[model samples]
Target: MWSTEDVARDAARRQGRGLSTAQVAEKVAEAARREQETRRQLDAPTETEIGPFATDPEHLAQLWAAKHTEWRRIAALLKTSGEQAYDPDRDAQGVTWAQERHARRQGALDRHAAWMRERQDARDELRTQIWLPADTSRRLRAIAARAGLQPEQVITQLADHVRMDEDGAVVVAPFTPHRVEGS
Candidate 1:
């Protein structure tokens, strides 16, 4: 992954210029300032102002279905492997092989849920009549994680830079672009 510095240096190198670490730090500081401003603009004074924190019915049903499917799959796996997976010695440590398998399966399910969340966010945007990819939301989440901030806290930090396409997009300008290989 290219850090902000890597990207700046890459751009400068392409333009036949030598970029310094101080320049990168300055740019990062500027970004931090911009993000702070955006966060202020995007702030919702109250939870009610934001509306609908829970998943919508359709997506909720999908999540339940997925959860059920995963539960059955993991049970079946356990049924088959529990014999080999469980060890009396590990049970003393409060970590049975069955528990290990369950953890692994649960981790996979969690990953799937994470991806599903991205899709669900995009769908929700569309339902509200916007066309932003969930990837933009993921970028928001990433920014929040990196900055030790809440998603809503920094959401509007770059709003001024957004350019909406025709048909009304959800959000503009992901912090990071998702590029497909071999366009």
Candidate 2:
């Protein structure tokens, strides 16, 4: 089999030149090293460039807002040039790389915003504070655990089973309290 060095040497011989196999090999190795360095530089993020903006979201937002006009101009240019939306597989570099990465991050941000709103809505209920004996608190927690619910949920369900009389003092109910061993 003709190895790469052998082929390179044969080509050099056919060209009637004084080039040696070691020289060809060295040039090829240098080219490979340069290409590797170029790729590394392209892929590595500059911490000094992104660190401050990444640490402060409000600052990042202000910067983005400030760039609105520039963004609009870029959008118009792209539109006029008939450039399509980013496709990760086809456009792995250049402007489209930023577009694809920002789109994915924005999607995640939107999902987190929705989840925060949901949690806020769920917590929009009457807030109350009451002191119970340590033993009572322990029993309440135990009951909640047995029913696979929060302590508040257990109280809410029990309250659901009760009705106040006209006097607002006498209450009739079907629930019977059960004793739980204290830990």
Top candidate when judged by TM-score against the true structure: 2
* Alpha-carbon deviation at 105 in model 2, angstroms: 3.9
Q: lDDT (CA) for every model shown?
A: 0.46, 0.51
Residue 54 displacement (Å), model 1: 3.4
Stretches of candidate 1 off by over 4 Å are: 1-50, 84-183
Clashing pairs in 2: none
Write model 2 residue lDDT over 1-183, tens digit each, in one string.
Answer: 333333333332333233233443444454455445544554663565655435443433333333332233333444454544312233223235345545766898999999999999889866688799999999999988876677877777677677888889857586643333441
Candidate 2 TM-score, true structure as reference: 0.27
Cα lDDT of model 1 by residue, 14-82, tens digit: 322232334434444544554454445445333434446743444333433433333333334434544
Best by lDDT: 2
Q: If candidate 1 were superposed on the true structure by all CA atoms, what would the RMSD be?
A: 31.2
TM-scores of the models, in the given order?
0.20, 0.27
How badly does each model clash, as a count of residue pairs? 3, 0
